[model samples]
Target: MIYTIHRTNQPPRYRGEWNDTVWQHAEIASIEKFHPQSSAFRPKTEVKALYDDTNVYIIFRVQDQFIKATYTTYQDPVYRDSCVEFFVMPMSPERGAAGYFNVEMNGLGMMLLYYIEDATRTTQGFEKFTKIPQERLRGMTIFHSIPAPMQEELTTPLEWIVEYNLPFSLFEAYLGELRPIAGTRWRGNFFKCGDDTSQPHWASWSPIGEALNFHQPDKFGLLQFA
Candidate 1:
């Protein structure tokens, strides 16, 4: 499973619009492989990615139901809400070295991100991990179709979009300079989940053999930057 990240000379405006001219040329991938534990309700989730000189842009469209979002603070657990996640390893972990980064965002645009060095499951969480400080993400831009702090669940059918751009400098801080990203290769996986929604479900772009885990970097698909 390889997804090409097309080069975009014209950066996206990050307005959460999927049909915009800049996004129309980008290839789309669907997050449809579901875990056996997921409920019968499965949302139609689609993702597209592009890269410019400064940042990597991504957008997610979810035709969903049973939407809910309560966590609003940075670094909070946003996976309990109607959420989309992107896990990427800019550089493969050779031996016990550089690890991957997970960016999880709720439907309302609230996000949780971490730099995980060791993903060994521990009582507190992973054996070794660091929450990417909010300050480092200042250059990142996010857009959401729905307003935030939704404490109540809405079971009606609806479509929501989440879009964001992550500056190359943000990744450079931890993974060193990622300049000349074109022609580069990385490993990543896209996911859609609602842990506490009325109809809980887990879906992924790259199929995961694990029962309910998204930390398997070996299961990630190839990301070819064009």
Candidate 2:
């Protein structure tokens, strides 16, 4: 479903607390269905986002009894574990389009930031699609929770949150230039996947179908700057 991301003049603090006024007012999107559309066991997942001029602030609250994440290094295969992902494609009414960026973080908050030339997860400035250039985002400031490596897989009932302030400059670095004005829309999707977890599941805000591929940008929902 298309989501209108509320514009906030002042985004919420990067802390994990979700009590901020902006979060209270905006509608939270819940991702419940599985990728194949036939799988059962829906996990509790809630996401809220806000965008200002400089950054887009996002928060995710996930509750699951069989959560698992082991990858701690940046750019590692976090999708194999319990992961939350944000794929944003900035658009222009006249220019028509720019590239998209994928910011994926496991439950331990390890992130992999990469720019896609197309829907197939091909990245720029790196020979391998899994390897991202650390030199590009030299001075960009970002934040995430659970910075330390999580040793054990959380099997008990667990509720966790991961928040980030993704800089617009980072998006522009890979996407050329973006002019997000009121009512402008971006093609994107949010995802939670765990290929190697105790309970493997792939859930998304926008349905990804039986392909089980998150790189399908054609099925992405619109994120309007409102």
Candidate 3:
């Protein structure tokens, strides 16, 4: 799907409604959250996105009936808690491998992921880039709050919103001189982890087959730059 931004506006606050069509429209809405049996746990999440000349913006509204997060080293691969993540791949006509960027956020707002590719090498017939920089990573100003007991009672569900702004400059090094042009398409996916379950559910703009993996950009949806 080629998505065009009607305008450049700040993020919108939710008005307490569940409507997928509203999300599918030009406006943003609460994305239907689901849990996959692959992990036996699921969290309710709503996501909305927008794009402009300089960057792409995304907002994720996550609801965790039971909130929990576990922290570890950068590459430790800890999956036992609540966290939100986004994967962005920038595609250029001349480039074979798109620029890979990822962001993962925990309940306490501890974010992790390399925003830039610092090194690359051919490993086992596959090219790999390692040691990306943290400075290249982007983040949201909105912080999730641990709601008070009474507030939790009034709402029944606890929701947290995460916003992001990914700049086009980050792709410059990967693309050399080339840049994303109109009608250009890239692969991407939005994922969430919950309650240290080791299995996280995934929602993507472009659907992959039975096995869900966002690393495959060729299977990603089309993103026509405007």
lDDT of 2 by residue, 1-226 (tens): 8888888867776677777776775668888767764235467888998888887788988886567767877788788778888888888676766566788888777778877664543345433343357775563444455556657777788777888777777766655667587888889989877777777888889988778688877888889888
Better of 1 and 3 by TM-score: 1
lDDT, residue 5, model 2: 85
lDDT of each: 0.89, 0.75, 0.51
> What TM-score number comes out for model 1?
0.95
Q: Candidate 2 — worst ten consecutive residues by lDDT sum?
A: 121-130
- The prediction achieving the highest lDDT against the true structure is 1
Q: Number of the top candidate by TM-score?
A: 1
Summing lDDT over every window of 10 consecutive residues in candidate 3, give the lowest-scoring window: 146-155
Residues 20-104, candidate 3: write the lDDT tens digits.
Answer: 3333434433333342433444556655655556656656777665555445345333334466766666766776554566566
- Measured with C-alpha atoms, the lDDT of residue 115 in candidate 3 is 40
Per-prediction tally of clashes: 0, 0, 4
- What is the Å distance of residue 208 in model 3 from its true position? 3.9
Q: Give the winner by TM-score: 1 or 2.
A: 1
Output the TM-score of candidate 3: 0.64
Query: Using Cα atoms with residue i matched to residue i, what is each candidate's TM-score against the true structure?
Result: 0.95, 0.87, 0.64
